[model samples]
Target: MIPLRQLPRLLRIAGVLARHRVDELLPASRRPRSLAWLRALMPAPGADLLVLPRGERLALALTALGPIFVKFGQILSTRRDLLPADVADALTQLQDRVAPFPAAQARAAIERAFGATIEARYASFDDAPLASASIAQVHAATLADGREVVVKVLRPDIHARIDADVALLRALAGVVERTHPSADKIRPQAIVDEIETTLVNELDLQREGANASLLRRNFAGSDDLYVPEVVWSHTSAGVLTLERVRGIPVDDLAALDAAGIDRVALAEKGVRLFYTQVFRDNFFHADAHAGNIWVDATRPADPRFIALDFGIMGSLPERDQYWLAENFLALFNQDYARIAELHVRAGWMPADARLDELEAAVRTVCEPYFTRPLSEISLAEVVVKLFEVARRHDLTLQPQLILLQKTLLNIEGVGRLLHPRIDIWATAKPVLERIWRRRSGPRAVLRTLRRRVPEWLAAAPDMPQLVHGWLSRANAGEMELRVASDDLKEIERRLRHGQRVAIWLSAGVSLAVATACVALLAPAGAPPGARWVAWLLGAAAVGAFALAARRS
Candidate 1:
């Protein structure tokens, strides 16, 4: 059941959709049948609004709905393969351009966060916002020590707003899961959980500051990329202060050209930087949209990327990191079979899935791209196509990978915008190969053993006792083994049958021995009937042995 407090907000959302005529965008088959009656309650859209393209109207409707929906639209914009081109293009405007809250409210938020007057915190503070996005807005400020910085303040009541909207989204996701035919494949609920986690992390400015600091440290002396330093003294949960830096937005081709920047070098550098972050450093900027990435114009010939907005950062499990690097290498080598094997081994695909079929599917998706010139090929598009094929073969989506996919799309887009003829695979392959060699080399293995051997030695003394305890538990019938594979289950069944046969055979042998002793060692005082009884028992033991042998 819907919460009473959420009904008004739900109605408001529906009314906004109706007011912009966004419902027309959804096909009749895909529309929620239960909410069909809500259309009657909606006010009719203006004729002028109706004349606009459905994609634009939908984007406008999402903007009207609030930051959460706008953010959703921004993510949707990246999946050009999944969405209509026109709609995707329209939704791209939502990235980092949400309407800002009032400056007075922003000031109040800052004051509340610091428990001090705005004048007391900084030497000089700008009331005007430098940039505004869904969760926060930034203002330029000067520190007491004469350093220029940017102060990021969270929006007022953002937590309550996001919580309420997230709850509503979860409810709707449940409805979709129940009603939609492809819900299992699409995984609406999992997507919501991923988005919720990202938003929750983004809400904490201190966490963002930490992420920035770590990234800065990782690339401390690198010429290819620069991360702004976080001002720890001025940062809090609700606000963050960072050393202010200026650069041309990566997407601004005209400005870059005016600054005499080498677009090709810049594009290649971006690709290499992405590989380094993911494969070597294992930490990456998850949100690498054009607005957040900028080009330093100081050295035109050797361009560098300046990263901002560290709210959404991503890393992978060590296993995933290795597998993904290998997967990329396999793709580069056109080793579809290896790719298929890697997917299964990495638990991305079901173990029982046909390797030949998966390999063929992957080839079908990737072969055409190879036929095209490297300049025209899109790494992001290839990954998306592979994902589509994997989905057909029951791919298990990893929630952690969602950010990586989005980041890849954003990075590729930025690269293409900078240099139309950039060869992403060529630029990334060498970087990946170097990292892979370092990680998988003999030195790496020795290093791992060196780190782990001491721990193993410390735990070695308990090995016998632990093994004894486990064996005792098994003998006591207190242990249960669960197997997921059909082959393993079949093997277990056969072993159980063999165990029962062995038990019966042992009983039979014991009975036969006892019967022989009774027959062979009978005293003269014993009745003659004892020998006959022993003979009968021997016959019964022989029968039991025959039954056990036949069953085996």
Candidate 2:
């Protein structure tokens, strides 16, 4: 049942739709008079024409609603294949714009969450937020020892609002599943589940703090990526304190140009950083939108990427990481057959399916881009085509792999935006090949064996006993292997019954055959009827044995 107070909000949402000429997107059964009444309350002259495009309007609407919608738009923006080009293009502009909460509120939240006063903990506290998004805002401050830091505070009562939206989405997803067959293909429920998990993780600033720490550790001693230090002493579930960062936004081409940064080199560096994260580290920043990325332009010749928003990071399973590395290398080398084989080996397709057919499909999707210059090829299109082929082959990707795919596409997009003629393969291929060789070559085998030597030594004492037990089992006719499961109970029962039938038939056939042989040898009581009976029994016994074998 719908809550009474929620009706007003729902009606207001309806009214906004009618006012903005987006009523068509809503269900048709809603009351037109109520919609008209809500539209009447809309301010005059409507929104600016520049913002009316579906994508831009979506961004504006999400921002107006708050963080939940903004986050949704961010995820949606990654799904270029599932969305219209215009809508997807516009959603790229959605930033986490939010009004910072007053300092008093920030203090109150910190106090409530940590049971301490701001002044007692820090040298000075600022009311002004360093950054604000839909769910949380960050404020700059100083520790008593004089270290600079930033505090992240969750938006007041944001969870209640987020929960409501998630519940609504869950309910709507059910309806879509029941009514639209396409919903099953797209897996709306799974998508919602991913969104829910990511949002929940982001809500806990402590998790974000830990994520930042892991990333910081991963990039330690590296010059390509910078992850800020988290102040563990002050971090909490709803609040986080970390080292403050200052850099030029990568998208600010004007600022980059003024700094005399080489746009081409910077773009290549971005691609390299991405490959390093995904292949070498297996951990990557999932959210690399322009706003979350910055260039440390202090050294124009050696520009480094400054990543923020660690709340939504990604990682792949070891198997997926290996497969992806292999896939990238295979595609770069134009090994279409290897790509097809990897898909099948990864259980992305049925074993009985025609490999030639899949190879043909891959060639069809990838052939057009072969040997083309970087400016002429669309990596994003290639990814979409791969996804389409996967769907046709009934390939269900691991969730982590999906994130990796999206992150790769996002990195490519950002790279191309910086330099239109950037060759992604040129920048990433060498890194992938090196990693692949290290992980798959003879050296890797030696390393793996070296790591396992201790365990092997520990097991050496048991080898003699293990071999003896194996030989003992081979000598004993009583030796048997059995597995138990409830699902096979009926089959087991049928097999037992069939075993008895086979035994009785075999005995009867043996008696008849012996009698026939004796009669034929003695020729004293031999008869045509007896011979016929013997032959019939022998045929019946053979048939029973065959049936029993099949049943077993």
Best by TM-score: 1
150-269, model 2: which lDDT tens digit per residue?
A: 898998888998888887766656756776647767677877887788889989999999999999999897777888899999999999999988889988999999998888988888
RMSD of each: 14.5, 15.7
Q: Given candidate 1, what's the lDDT at residue 410?
A: 79
Score every model by TM-score. 0.80, 0.78
List the lowest-lDDT window of 10 residues for candidate 1.
543-552
Candidate lDDT values, in order? 0.82, 0.75
lDDT of 2: 0.75
**Over the stretch 276-389, how does candidate 1's per-residue lDDT look in tens digits?**
899888999987888889889998988899999998788999999988998999999999999999999999989999999999999999999999998899998899789878
Question: What's model 2's lDDT at 374?
Answer: 57
User: Which stretches of candidate 1 lie above 4 Å from their native place?
Assistant: 19-21, 33-56, 75-92, 460-552
* lDDT score at residue 199, model 2, on the 0-100 scale: 88
